[model samples]
Target: MTNPKISLILSAYNEEKFIKKAIESVINQTLKDIEIIIVNDGSTDDTLNIINSYGNSDSRIKVINQENIGLGASRNKGMKIASGEYITFLDGDDWFATDAFEISYKEAKSKNTDITMYQMINYDDESGRVYENDWFNLNNLDESFDNIVFSPEKTKNFLFDLSVSSCQKIYRNSFLKSINASFPEGIYFEDMPFFFHVYLKAKRISIIRKHLYYRRKHDASITHVVDANYLDTVEAGCELMRRFIDNGFYEDYKFDLIAYKINGPRMALMDIREDAKKPLFKLIKEDYEKIKKTKYYQDYLDNLGPKKKKFFLDILKYDNYTEFKKNNPEY
Candidate 1:
């Protein structure tokens, strides 16, 4: 048989409650010529059994049962074995809009882009409501530029503005393979670095305004549960900035990288307990102080947007929340 047009990799760990819905959503996609590779990462729940039930009935659905590795490793396993022209990822707890793959596949083909990105709606399970991710809305180009194909250099600023969620876009399988892209095996925030790697390696990327992905907002999700592992985001962001410098693309991407560095600690504080906030912020602040001494630091700050510059400067000045907030009222 011919390989499928797109390969959808779904990674899950003990997500029995939402696994069925997520699987069914894949089956209902408007794009039929696709393969679904589900990696059940040591799910203690009935997630493996549920995946088996579907895999038994559908030829397109393939399931991999493994010991509880992290999400990045599971996704890597799925991608290594994926047999499709294009590749995309899905969280086992989040479902996509019906035509997501169809639309993204067509766009990638027609525009000849290495990646095709679209917007996502954040679904609130408790409220049973869906809303556009405010971050995504900020990256939307004016109507005149809707459905535009942009070079990575052209969209450097927007890379920071747009959602870096892996599931928000579809990538050419060859493009990913050519770059030998893989997630950080045991990390919580692997997507951040992985996302940046893709953009940096790709020549062209296309963006459309359509909301193709639905990201469920629930406390139990990995992102919502704050712990030491949550610091992975800070580590990921720093590593991403370091990569830009090593590749000599730091100047072009410095503003966005600085923006990421500042916002990461702020967002981390929101989910973390009060007791952990101060220490975490202090670590971030000290790290930034060291980064500030680098030659590229001034260049990054010089290119930063006015508001972003103020927030970053404020973060550098104050480690405590009260002082930070007092000085940066606009936040």
Candidate 2:
């Protein structure tokens, strides 16, 4: 199908159980003019077999198999071979709303958007509690507008608040290729850097004021796991900030970048193992030391109150998470 309306890139690893649900969600969509590209990233389970079965039955489904190269690389492969006007990624463990395509694509085409953003629902498997994330709410403009569209530069204040997950946004294929936009390889926090790449290149952005994606949160999810790979958070933050500086956008978004770097990793750090606390804390302080050398660090650092500033400094003294948790008030 030449120039399919949308290309859905599905990346799967060992997600046999969830992959079926994810694929069905796409198949069940109201918009059927789409090509589903499923990348079976070296699945050591029945994932590949399941993917192949679907491809055999559906002429629109395309399957690619390769050794485990991580999520970012897998998505990059799909994007390379994509033959669609618009592209969006769907994790093997996640699903899209029935009208995600019809709704988002219509607005994207009408606005000529380089990037189309939408809200997401976080599904917690253990407790069966599902909640909507307002990161893509666009509340400030909702009262005056329905489908908000503009250059991200015009609303720089919303830059940091934008959703970093690829599943929450759709991109114009030609626009992404023109800017050479792709996910960062060899890192666990690839989403952060890739989102920054879009943030840097996107000019005309539009939004769907509805939840169009469902992200599963469970013990098996990578975000909930803690290991050496967790160290990639610091590196991802640095890469994102470095890109902003390289593109000459850092000075304008310095404070937000710095604050996100320090705070963004905190949620994952809270689940760090006892053995990794000291080493991880050491790196965190070292990361701050690197931040201090930046030209705008002092400008923003000075703006912080004495107590808030002390909290940053105080974190350096502790070698253990417990000691820090007991005495230090800062996260």
Candidate 3:
């Protein structure tokens, strides 16, 4: 067969229950000339069997079976063998809208962008709820830290507040290869660091406000089942911070990004409505000290007004951030 224009890579682990639906979503895509690379990460379940069923019928579907390497490694493996000009990633449990690839491909071609990101909707199966789509409005482009635009400084600032999810974006294969980009192996937040690097390298990017991806909430998913391993995600964020600093990207946006990472886990723990009082306080104190010792710390702290400075100091003092939730219940 001829080489495909796009390669859809899916890193799956024990997704037998939803794998078929995910595959069907891709098989039914409105766009043609695409190949599906399904990397089976040694699922003990019948995920491989489901993939074989599709592979048997469709020449475009290729399956790679390997030992239970993590998602990052699986994606890297798939990319190595992909023959497409463009690349897109999907989780095994997530489904895409029929027109997702079609629309994205057309827009990317028209704009000659290296990356294209669109809106996504979160689907909660257990709660029977579908959250409204979260989109990036490019109409009033700030060209600053706030609005999503294509500048190194603005991109760095945006990473402080939000890290791009792989599922939401499509990347040009040539650009990815030129940057030697691959997901960091054995990392929990595999998408964030790599996404940041790509955003920094991208010359042109397109943001489509239409919701075209369905991010399903499953019980067995990693985010739902938190354990000690979840700490790896926090460490991954730290690694990204260190990388940014070493590369001098942190000079302008050090404080904001550090604050975001330092408080990220604490905020997550708070959202679960569980008491993380002691550990949270300990982590806050440790991070605060680390920040204080950094060269940029004092200047960043000085730039913060009275209220914000007190807030960081209070995080070190308080056992838990539950008090903030109490005052601002909506948060």
User: Pick by lDDT: which candidate is best?
Assistant: 1
Residue-level lDDT of model 2, residues 177-251, one tens digit each, is 997888888788898888887867888887777888888887788877787678778778878877877778777
Ten residues in sequence with the least summed lDDT for candidate 3: 138-147
Tens-digit lDDT track for model 1 on 1-331? 8989999999999899999989998989999999999999999999999999999999999989999899999999999999899999999889988998899999999998898888888888889898875675535455645667777766555767666789988999999999888887776888887888888888888787788888898978777678777767667777777667766776676666777766776677666766776677676777778878988678657876786676667768886767875765443
Assess each prediction's global lDDT (C-alpha) against the native.
0.81, 0.80, 0.75
Total colliding residue pairs, candidate 1 = 0
Ranking by TM-score: 2, 1, 3
The most accurate candidate by TM-score is 2
How far off is residue 64 in model 2, in Å?
1.5
Model 3: how far is 286 from its true place, Å?
6.9
TM-score of 1: 0.84
Sum up the clashes in candidate 2. Answer: 0
Per-prediction TM-score to the true structure, in the order listed: 0.84, 0.88, 0.80
Note the clash tally of each candidate: 0, 0, 0
